[model samples]
Target: MALSVLAEENILLNQQLATKEEAIRLAGQILVDNRYVEADYIEKMLEREAMTSTFMGNLVAIPHGTDDAKKDVKESGISIIQVPDGVDFGDGNIVKLIIGIAGKGGGHLDILSNIAITVSDIENVENIVAATSAKSILSFFERVN
Candidate 1:
């Protein structure tokens, strides 16, 4: 059976992150804690940010490791963080929702694409950002895609 990508324990709601790096670490740490990725994958996630911003607009940021860091993945999983106040992702981008991804092999594309499609709608993005329960967010994603 395929493992669930977004576990309830991996979702953090109503958080206030001071920096983008802290937000990234918080997101990536969930993956590490859940055994979805090696601890070192968090550092690689930072390196990915240096390469390019993961900001997807509508106050969302998807942080993932670089292509070379795929080896650090143990399984396909995602960590979600809801920052109601929003964290600055630089260049005036304030991200209220953060999705950290650890995909084995080329699975990141599928995860990214699904999220992209779901968040493309402003209503969906708003709903996700305002979600107070992990199950609500998870069910929203499942319903959308």
Candidate 2:
């Protein structure tokens, strides 16, 4: 069962987003457009944001649907969008990478672990942020896999 997290199809490189909400919305759309989640999952993600900040540090933000959105996930999927200038996620946190996540069953845990391991190293996150093309970013996951 492929979790399909962070694939080339779900990546948007060098994106310029004006606001955190827009960034979150665009990231959720990537998953929806790819059929990884239901259309309403975007709203769920926004709802989750209201509860707590998904800021995981290392210039990264892992935004996922709220508990209510669990039923909205059609398949497990993730989308990684890079903001070159970064987006302020409030409290002075600028997120260079916004990772939108959706999961079916418990598969999302695998995605979380993979992302945690990949970005645990600051330099690895930097490399991902510096990737010029989506292919390169996909390769980064391959190398990790």
Instruction: Report lDDT (CA) for all predictions.
Output: 0.91, 0.88
lDDT of 1 by residue, 15-91 (tens): 99999999999999999999999999999999999999999898999999988888899999999999999999999
51 Cα displacement, candidate 1 (Å)? 1.2
lDDT of 2: 0.88
Residue 110, model 2: lDDT of 88
TM-score of 1: 0.95
lDDT of candidate 2 over 1-145, digit per residue (tens): 2335667889999999988899999999999999988899999899988889988999999999998798999989999999989999989999999989998898888899888888778788889899999988888877875
Listed in order, each prediction's TM-score against the native is 0.95, 0.95
Lowest summed lDDT window (length 10), candidate 1: 1-10
